[model samples]
Each structure stands twice: as structure tokens, then as C-alpha cells.
Target: MVAIWLDGRMRPSTAASVLVISARQVQRLLRRYRESGAGAIRHGLRGRPSNNRIDCGVRDYALAIVRETYADFGPTLAAEKLAERHGLTVSSETLRKWMIDDGLWKNRAQRRNFHPPRLRREHCGELVQIDGSDHRWFEDRSPACTLLVFIDDATGQLMQMRFVPSESTFSYFEALEGYLKDHGRPAAFYSDKHSIFRVSKTEARTGHGMTQFGRALAELNIEILCANSSQAKGRVERANRTLQDRLVKELRLAGISDRAEANAWLPTFIEQHNAHFARVPARPKNLHRPVNEPASRLRDILCWRDERYVGNNLTVSYERKRLILEDSDLARSAVGHYVETYAFADGRVDLRWKGVSLPYRMFDKDQQRVTHAAIADNKRLSEVLAYAMEMQKAAPPKMPRTGKQRTRYEPTGLRSPGPKSLLAKRAERRVAEAAAQAVE
Candidate 1:
């Protein structure tokens, strides 16, 4: 269009129309092309660096921090940390480009998925998604264990987390206790169809068709919802994935190997994690209800409870152990009545009748299995088996028998052995005489 206009073969208006610009723009470009000879078509700032580009020293510092502290963090998270912690004001996209150029990060191809996204709850504590992740959290430093995660559905905040051996009822009980004390009771708990939360069998002859965990939640007036699939409880499942990546590294950095130390350090990590990842609730109001129940009542509700009938001797058999109730007026009247037995996670058992604790002496019917207080789940099966083998090796060898054992023999058929007593001899002689008379 400019060439036609320069050659005077076409009008500026026609050239402007062809070039998709105004006539004035065509005239301006034509004059510039006359002066600069096609060089004027290039942008003036093409070869210059961006004025808003980050300084070299700042970029170096940010990259150093990423390498040193957050090498595995995603670009967005790394950018956030760079700004918040190191005062490097870089955008996530810019940081991602830089990381890609530096070979510190890679861009992954996006994949289509079938699970639809669910909206967050309206208020905090409206729903808490609970899950247990079995991971080698401590790497090879310690035995693998399960981490119980309690995440709020409304805000995507981690309510509580604990390192346990397995996803057992007792482990959940302990985690629930901590959650109750820390954040009070949530309206409902969201979880999978684990036996701890739901009775999987339809014909299960257990406590009113509810699991121990379900019963405990019912006692606390907290509803338990079991998701049909893992994607249904995706909040906690995703949290587990994040923890398996970040928490494991955190534990490694902190030199923590055991559950006790990991537990102690968990609060700090949770606070930090929530600060970065937690989202604002849709509603400002907190939905968590205060725990109005007394500590004792709460303790009772959170324990493993079973019913046993008191015998005529005022004794109750539990787990093959006899509990002899003290002879009292209450005990005497308790005979033939049903009593409740509460077993706490801390290994304490309380026998109660009509909400009153009964005094009793335990007569152990069998020795209990050797158990470790720190261990909780099957993640440590290998360690437990190794320990058992070691114990067996350390045990004293059994003594060998010295002499052959004798076997008692009896006379065959109707023939009798020689009698040792006078009464036996008389009986034998009478039998023989009767036999001889019959023969004659």
C-alpha cells in the first residue's frame, strides 16, 4: 500500500483502506519510510531491555533462595516466598520463565480429567474433610507411618494433622480429641468409607450399624459423611499429596525421624502452611460450634466403649480379663445388669454403671501382646516383624529332655493284670471262678 502511494499510482485513501489504517496514518508512514527506508517500520523499543525488568542482583538472589530453600516448589509458590520472605518482587509468570531458562523447573503438559470441581463450603467448620495418608514421610530415617489430616472444606485450611502408625479408630480418636480441643467441633466430618468412619459390611452385627468412630461422632452431635469415592473427598486427598511432597521435605530439613518429634513440629508447619495455602471462606462467620460438653463427657464419648453383663459374682469379662467389682451396695445391685466398658487410647479402661465409675480389680486371664506405645499402624509392619525376630533371637533356649518317657499299658481283651489291692484281687478271683463254672 505504501509503495503504491509512493509511486502515485493510487490515492492515500485507497492505500489506507488496503493497509487497514486511516489516511493520516498512511501519510505519516509514507513520510517516515521516505526518511528511514524501511527501518522506520520496526518498533523503536525492539532492541532495548524492558524498563520494568528485575535487576540482575535481585534475580540472582531470588534464584539462590529458590535453589537453597524451595527447589521443589512450583513457580507460583516460589514467587510468593521470594516476595514475602526475601523482598523480591517478581511475578509468577516471570519467575516461571526465569526458572525454565535456568533449568530449575519444567512446564508440565495439562491433562483433561473427568472429576468436576466442587465449590467450597460457605463457612469455616461447616465441613471438615478427614483422611489418613500412609507415606514414607521420614524417608528411610524411620519406619513409614500414616499422617491423619483434618482439612476444612470451606477455607481449604488444615485444621489439624498428626503422625500415627495407621488409620485405626484409636488413632482417629486421638486426632479428634486434638481437633476438638483446638478448633472445637465441626458441623460434620467428610471422609471415605474406611472402617474407622463407616461400617462397610451390610450384615455387620456391630454397634447399631455404626462404626466406633461413627458412634463417637454421633455422641458428640457431629455428623459423619462418608464419600462414595476418593474424588468426593478430594480436598483431603489433594492435601495429602501436597503434604507428601512438602511435609516430607520439611521433616527431612528439620531432622525429624520419629512421630513424636514430627508431631511436635507439626503445629509450626501447619501454621506456615495455612498462611500460604488457606483460602478465605465464602462467608465471614465461623461455623465451628463450641464444645459445651465437659472434658470427662467428651473423653467418654471419644473412647472405645462396649457393653458387658455383670455376672452373679459382680464380675465382668472384658478382652479375656476378669474385672472383679468391689463388694458394695452398688456392685451387689449391679448383678444381672448391663455395664459399659470404656477403653481409652492411653490404655486406661473404666467400667461404668449408670454413668458412675465402678471400682474393680483386674485378674488377667492371658498375657497381653507386646506392644509399643509409639506405634499405631501397619506401615510399621516390617519394623514390628524385625523387632519380633530380634526378641526371639535374644530369648533363652528351651531345655532338652534327658530320658525317654514311659507309656502306660493295659491288658488286652478279657485277661486282667495282676491286682495290686486286696479289693481288686477279690473282684478278679470272683470273675475267674464265675467263668470256670460257666465252662464246666
Candidate 2:
């Protein structure tokens, strides 16, 4: 443009339009080009120091203080401490450069581990990401707990939120039950490879590769997808991070220190959060289908279900409890067969055979004792330890089976029956004598 303008082939206005610069600026460039040739295109202040440069003494003093005191601090924090503590005001970027030059800090390029970004589902309820975040939600005021978060992939809206003691199958069942009630049934749920969603063990002996929660979803005709990585279900993971910050502060402000209160308050926070962060879906269609089952039936679907084989005595052992079925025709028929056991959230257990509920009584064993090899997941470790401690306090100190009372078995100083055969013969004689006396 300058050459054309200088040759008078193009007007100054035309050159200005082509270069997207003012006509006067174009004229100035043309004048400089004519006088000094192409070398004039370089900036005049290329090698000059900035006019607002700090004094050498001040720069030295700031760097000295930072090295002596805030050596491990980042540029931004070091700058803040310099201004606050020493009255030395310096921008973070300026300090960053100076620290880099002084070898106190190194300017490192941020290297991001690239992941293939997944596009959001077009319709709402097409995919909902579910996760449980175990955190100190109440800070130091209360014990840490897990928060189950349900978020939509399409709109990024929080579909449901619940605070639970831990990430267990039962906890997930309760949260999912609430979600199904509110939002009906979604096409599918996206989740991490938690055992509640997927059977992690390849050689799992029970449920035929399906988890209890997975079975519930299958029964409801809903699909559940297990993500290979946290980034695959990034929506719920990111929401957990945000809630850890915002929701924790909100709970503190509301003076909520327990799961119950926080759970009751979560609905309002979810609404506000969705209002701020939710996006409009690409396709403005709702893919959620209404559940046709009643609430009672839905609850039945959400509970822990397993099959226990009834013994000859019409009893089934479950969770260290002997379920003694009532003596009836149904109970007799159920013996030597597998009866389905439904354990509900509210501590109710029902025994059913062929869809007929058989009345039963629970004979509890020492289920409360934490066995030597009891395995608890990382998320539930706190709760498990707490309960173990409580049980330890209440239960008697365990005695070794082989520990002797000194050296030998001391006589208990009480009468003992000689033998089972003799006792049975005496009982028969007594009954026969009673029958003869009655006839007389």
C-alpha cells in the first residue's frame, strides 16, 4: 500500500481504507518510507526502556524481601504479601518477570492433558450424570459426608441433590428413588465406575455381573452407563467441585451442620445454581418418560433384593439373622426353595415366594460386630469406623476361645445332665407314667 501510494497509483484515502488505518497515519508511514526506505518500518522505541520502569533500588529491595520471606510463594501471592506487609506495591505480572530473572521463580508453561471432549446430549433427560462427592461439607462443624449429585448433560441443570453418610448402594438407591419421583425416568444415567454402578471385580460370584443399584435401574427399564474415566462424566465431577465451594459456604451461612438440614435446604440451592449455570439445550425437547408404577412399587424396586434358600426348618440366614418363617402352608411350601428377600430403607424385611409375602420373624445374630476381615470402601470408612467404635463400647470385651481359667477346666459347682440319651429315656418314662396315672 505504501509503495502504491508513493507511486501515486493509489490515493492516500484508498490506501487508508485498504490498510484499515486513518488517512493521516497512512500519509505518515508513506513519508517515512520515502525518506528511510524499509528500515523505517521498525518501531522507534524498540530498544528503549519503559517510561514507567521502577527504580533500581526499589526493584532490588522488593526482590530481596520476596527471596528472604516469600521464597516459596507464587507471583500473585508474593505480590500481595509485599503490598500488605512491606508497603511495596507491585503487580503480579511485574513480580513474575522479576522473580524469573532473579532465578527465584521459573515461568512454566501450562501443559494440559488433552482429553477428547464429548458433546452434550441434544435433549434434556437424554443423559444425566450421577456421582457422589465425599467432602467436609460442613467444614469443622460436623463430620464429613457424601453428597450425591445428579446433573443433566444437555442443560447442565442439577436434577437432584442429596447428602448421605456414605456412597453405598442403599444411599444411591434412596437418592435415585427421589430423582425418579421428581424427574420421572431418564433415558440413561452416566456415572463413574463405582461399585454401586458397576461390578468392578471380574470374578464376581453374585448378581451375574449386575450390582444392586444396576438391578434396580434395569427393573425400572432405565439404562446406566459406566464411564471409563472421571473426564468421561465430567459434568457431575465439575458440579461436585463447584458445590464443594458454593454449597459449603451456603450451608455455613444457613447454619446447617447436619445432613438432614442440608438435605432439606439443598433444593433451594440447586434452583439458584441451575438458574445461574444451566444452559438451554441444543434441542428443546425433554426425553424424560413418566414412570407408570406407583410409589409403593417404586420403593420395592429401589430396595436391596436377594434370594435366600429356605432351610428344612423354614428358616433362612441373611446378614447374620435367621429369618424364621411362620408355620403355615405357604411357609412349608417355601422350604427347600429360594425365597426372595426384600430389605427396605426403613428397616423392613419381607420374604416372598412366587410374589406372595410370607410372614416371618427375625432372629438376629451378632451382625453388629465388625469382623476381622470386614471390608469397607474408602468413601464409607469414616462411618464404618464410627459404628465400630460405638459397637466396641457397648459390646462385652471379646474373650479368646482357647484362654484357660488358670490351667484346667474348674468345676462350675452346678449340676449337669449326664447324657442326651439318658435324658430322653427319663422324659419318656415320665410321660408314660403320667398316661398310666390318668387312666387310673
lDDT against the true structure, per candidate, is 0.87, 0.90
Candidate 2 segments whose C-alpha is farther than 4 A from its true place: 1-113, 403-440
Write candidate 2's Cα lDDT for 114-161 as tens digits: 689999999999999999999999999999999999999999999999
Model 1: per-residue Cα lDDT over 1-440, one tens digit each: 67777888999988888879899988888888999988897667899988877788988888889989999999999999988987888999998988888889987743234688889899999999999888899999997888999999999999999998777788899999999999998999999877778777888765688988999999889999989889989999989999999999999999999999999999999999999999999899998888999987888888899999999988898876888999999888889999989999887889888888899998774434334554533545654666566766776545766666546454467865564898888999999999999999
The parts of candidate 1 lying over 4 Å away from their true place are: 1-113, 370-440
Query: How high is the lDDT of residue 335 in model 1?
Result: 97
Worst 10 residues of 1 by lDDT: 367-376
- Show the colliding residue pairs in model 1: 165-377, 166-377
Deviation in Å, model 1, residue 108 alpha carbon: 22
Candidate 1: TM-score?
0.61
